[model samples]
Target: MGDGSLRRIAALARQDARLLARDPAPLIVRTLMPLLVMGFTQPLFRAALRAGDVPDANGAEQGVPGMAVVFLFLLVNVVGFAMFREHGWHTWDRLRAGPARSFELVAGHVLVALAAALAQLAVVLGVGGALSGLRVRGSWPALAVVGVPLALCVVMAGMALVALCRSISQLTVAANLLALLLAGLGGALTPLSVLPDWARPLAPGVPSYWAMRGFSTVVLDGGGVVDVLLPAAVLCGFAAGLTVVTLVFFRSAHPKLTWS
Candidate 1:
């Protein structure tokens, strides 16, 4: 890409960041809601971990990271909503007619979403630890290894949804369904060791499972960067696959509608 194109994506990313800042309620709410939920569920998580043979395990070890992963996946929908809102506001064509390519437009959204997702993860983990005793117990760099790839997966998944969905309603339903389904199947809702035998095999297919794997290794087992490499690589594979799907299905001229 040329310097000019880079500049355009940067400019659009800045604009999108500003727009996101303008409506911080969703971000604030997601952040606070997880903390509140952990308050009520940490004991339960601790009990489950104890039952799993980690007799000394505090609930925060499971509660904090699990809830963070769930919310992180939930936040993926924001990317789709942001992109679809352009069409709702009748601005997508105008933006399309501008100098930026469709790829650049989507790139801008991806950049913003990636940043927001990372920040959200950091905030949730940090505060949850401070308030709920969720310690890292391992390498901070290892945490980043898991977090960055997970964030990339989220943005790519959002882009894929935007490519596939034609209406706001469809996008909303798909994004939410995928978020919940992926989180639940991936063992974010409960530990993989505790899941029924038939469902245990399905967790590895979802990005959230790798994320939780990396996180649990760090937060619960004191594992370092080396321990997380496999999960990180798997997350990158998921992100790459989603990117291919988005590229294959997305078209600059595709029309989007706000279902009434």
Candidate 2:
């Protein structure tokens, strides 16, 4: 809040952005990998559709949105991994030792993750537009409003993971496992309608599900801006709650640095 804190946050953001730009692997994986998967899987799903295997409702209409959700998951995972690596290598310690506060650290990492998420979103949208001929039917501004909070949720989730993890390997394994589970439950790999009745209740609990539904409703379902309000609010709450939890976890883990 103070000028010093604001300057520190700005510095950290600039440093993180430079590091992210220098490393192209995570960028490629986060932005392009999902597009590739969608490209390859579209034909398989189409064939399944023709053969009456995957069901018609689970075809392009549902699949495209679901794939976009998966791409978002990839973006979250990449950011999580990058954060884990930086924390493991003591980069976070160095930053904290500098002018950066805990909030600044979180903000900087979230900013970097947001950049990656936006790039990933653009790639998915481009690919979906070109290949699947997908179109956004609702208001673009509303979609953008919904997307910003969702990306923050993802970044906070990554921070929570970094705070909870003791080692890089553990962080990597946990991140991947959680990403896979959330993606599956959130209709990334399959449509929510195709899920069992008992599983219906669980979808709303996963962050990715809200993100996917919010985006699809605004972009593909021609829904009103009000329709996305609940999901966007939920994602914002998720981000805020997880941020508090991450801060507490970090404080507990590094008691010596509590006042640093």
Candidate 3:
């Protein structure tokens, strides 16, 4: 990237971070709710571990990663709502009045969303370790194998959806439904092994599924960094595709929107 582009992205990302910092709602909702769910699901995870001779199994492994995945979907709203937020606040036109390119602006928001995802995942996983005795049986580098690519995919996919939404209510309904649906279908709500025979085939379509698998390998199967390379590559591919879609959708919609 050119220095000019880098400067634009950095400046805009700083602005986004400031704005998001002012609102604790996203942090509270995404962070607290998942922790609560993780705590609530501890027993089931314990039972599942106990019922089987699953190697290196623990409650946190069974629960924390899935909870983290589920909340990743819910947390995407912070990124998906970027454009609609300006519209609601009556600042869209003013933002468009700025000299920055639309790509720069959009890229900044995506970076912010990625930041949120990374923080949420780390925090959730950290708490799981601290409070729930979550263990990392594999290389720490393998953790990033899942987390980084998953964050990018989630944010890019969210930005793509943002282009389709005209208002917060529309985005809210769409995000909530999509998040819940993906969580359920991607094996975040439950392990794919336990799902019905027919449903397992569909899990591969979602990035979260690969993310869950990557985490599971490291946390449950005592996998090395190489073990998760495929899942991480798959997630990076999803992020790339989603990035293309996001840019195409935003470019197509920008001219018609009041903000762009």
Candidate 4:
């Protein structure tokens, strides 16, 4: 809360940003792959939506948002690995010994992750509109209602994984599994109505489901902020819960091995 804390957080954020800039493969892959997937799968989504009674659907309505959610979740690697690499390079201890408090360190890294997630989301949406014929039928504010919380949830989920996993391999496995599970189960891969009966019921429990719901309401249904309120709130709840888990479980003293 003090100036000193703010300074520390800013400094830490700058360092992490520099590192990310130096090695940008994760960001590029996460963003580019989704666009490629959307390109190849748009026709498929269009047909599927038509079969489901959305006669006007252009596939971008489904494909664009779906790919955004899936790949945004996959960006978890950007957050989880950033922390793991700090330990891998034997810099975590040095960081801990510095003047920055634990909260400041985490906050700084989180700021960077949050910015990256939002920027990626914006790029995907912009490019989606240009390349895939995606358009927002609803309010742009409503879109942010869905996107901001979704990004926060993803960042917290990544932090939670780092807090819980003991080694680099464990973090890698858990992060990947969580991303895929959340995406698939949340209807990012397909509409919830089309998912298996058992999976449909569980869709509400995952953040991506709400994200997709909000996107559908906005991009497909032409809904406004009021329509997306529930999905945004649910995403915020998930982010808050994950944040608590990360704060409680994360420790400077925890031994995070670089490898299995």
Report backbone clashes per prediction.
Answer: 0, 0, 0, 0
The residue pairs found clashing in candidate 2 are none
Lowest lDDT block of 10, candidate 1: 251-260
Tens digit of lDDT per residue, candidate 2, span 113-155? Answer: 7777776676666576567755567876677667778777777
- Candidates in descending TM-score order: 1, 4, 3, 2
Specify the highest-lDDT model's number: 4
Instruction: Quote each prediction's TM-score.
Output: 0.97, 0.85, 0.91, 0.97
Relative to the unseen true structure, what is the C-alpha lDDT of residue 96 in candidate 4, on a scale of 0 to 100?
A: 95
The Cα error of candidate 4 at residue 28, in Å, is: 1.4
* Model 3 residue 240 distance off true place after TM-score fit, in angstroms: 1.1
Question: Could you tell which candidate, 2 or 3, scores higher by lDDT?
Answer: 3
Q: Give the per-residue lDDT of model 3 (tens digit) for 1-260.
A: 79988898898889888988898687768887888888888777777766665645567877888898888888767776666677667676676777667788788788877888898888888876678888888877898778999888888878877777665666677888888878877778776567568778888998888988998899878898899999999999999998888777775235223332
Give the alpha carbon lDDT tens digit for every residue of 102-128 in model 1: 789989889989999898899888888
Model 3 is weakest, by summed lDDT over 10 consecutive residues, at 251-260
Name model 4 segments beyond 4 Å from true: none
lDDT by residue for model 4 over 1-260, one digit each (tens)? Answer: 99999999999999999998999888988888888999888998888898896888888988988999999998887799899888888899999999988788889899999999998898887787679988778987898889999999999999999899998788778878998999899988987667888898889889999999999999888999999999999999999999999999999888898862
Over 4 Å off, model 1: none
Q: In model 2, how many backbone clashes occur?
A: 0
Model 2 — which ten-residue stretch has the worst lDDT?
A: 251-260
Q: In model 2, state the lDDT of residue 18.
A: 84
Give Cα-based local distance difference scores for all models. Answer: 0.89, 0.70, 0.79, 0.89
